[model samples]
Target: MSKDPDLELVKRFKEEGSLESFRALYERYKDKVFSTAFAICGNYAEAADVSQETFFLIYRKIKRFSFKSRFSTWVYRLTVNVAVEKRRSRKEFLALSEIGEEVFEHTGDTPLETLERTERDALLNRSLRHLSPKLRTVIVLRYFQGLSYEEISSILGISMGTVKSRLFRAHRELSPLLQRPPFSAPPGGQEDAWQGN
Candidate 1:
C-alpha cells in the first residue's frame, strides 16, 4: 500500500513539535473534521466546537500517538469521538439540511431535478436525525464520509462484522422513513459497497 500522504508532516510535528507542520496538518484536515463533526452533531456551531476540541486534543496528545494506524484514520476517529461527546450534551437532534451542497454532487441537472433532489436530500437528512448516534455514525462514516468497511471498523474500534451489521440495521430503519428508494451511497461508491466481505 502507498504510504499515508500525511506521514511526513505528522512526523515533523510529533518529533520536532513544529508549529508549521501542525498548521499544515490542520489545513489538510480541517474541512473533513468539520464535515464529519457536522454530520454527527448536525448543528454548525457545535460542529465547529467539536472541530476545535478535536484539534486541541490532538495537539496535546500527539506525542502519545502510536503509529499503529494511519494518521488520517486516527484524526477521523478523534473527530467522531468529539462529535459524539458534543451530541450527548445537546437535547435536540438537528438535521443536516445545510449540508446538501456537500453531500450531493452538482451534476448540472435541470431546474426541476435540482428542486426534487434538494427536497429528497432534505428528507434524508431529517430521517437521519431520527437514528441513534451509533447508527448515525456508521451512516456518516460510510456514506457521508465515503469510508470503506475496514476503515470504518478501524475508526470505530469495532470488528468488520459489527460494522456491516450496524449498516444493515441502519438501512432497514431508514427504508421506511425515506418512503422511497433508499438513499444512494456517495458518488463513485458501489451499491455492493455495504455487502459482506
Candidate 2:
C-alpha cells in the first residue's frame, strides 16, 4: 500500500551497489515507465528507447537524487522529459499494431468494431502531435494515467494552476481536430465511439 519500498531499494543500491537491487527497481517500475512513454509518444520503438534511457539515468544518477520528491515522481519526470525530448521534432506515424489493444480495447464486437476502435485511437494519437509538449504531458498524465492535477504538478515540478491552464489550452486546440470528420463511429458501432481524450 505504500511506496516506501522504492526508497529502500534506492538506498540499498546506493550503499551496496547491488545489481540485484537495481534489477528489482527496474522490474518493479518498467511497465509504468514504458507505458508513460508510449502513452505520450504513441510509438513502441521510441517508448522503448525512452524507457531504456530512464533506467540508464536512474543507474547513473541515483546517488545525486535528493529524495526531496518521491522516487516515483522523479522517475516519471525523467521518463516523460526524455520521451518528449526524443520525439520533439519527429512526426513518426504509428501503425495500430505498434500500440496494443489496451489503447483500443473499449469494445470487440466484431472485426469492424475493432478496426473502428483502432482508427479512433490512431486519430486521437495523431491529434496529440498538434499539442505542445507541455500540453501533451499534462494530457497524458491526466487522461491516460488518470493522475490528479496535484500529482502531475508534483511530478512535473509545476504549479497546479499551470497544469489547469495547459489542459485548458490543450482542449481548445484539440477540440476542432478531435471533432473532425474521421471521428464518426463505424457502421456497426455506437454514435460516439471515441471516449478517452
Q: Rate the local accuracy (lDDT) of all candidates.
A: 0.83, 0.78
lDDT of 2 by residue, 1-197 (tens): 24655888888898889889999999998988988899777777788899999999999998888877778778888998898788766755342235576534565378888777777777777568667778888998898778788889998889999999999999999897777666564335555434422
Model 1 ranges off by over 4 Å: 97-113, 180-197
Query: What is the alpha-carbon lDDT of model 2 when measured against the actual structure?
Result: 0.78
Question: What are the clashing pairs of model 1?
Answer: none
Error of 2 at 52 (Å): 0.8
Report the error of model 1 at residue 175, Å. Answer: 1.7
**TM-score of every model versus the real structure:** 0.81, 0.75
Best by lDDT: 1
Off by over 4 Å in 2: 1-5, 88-113, 183-197
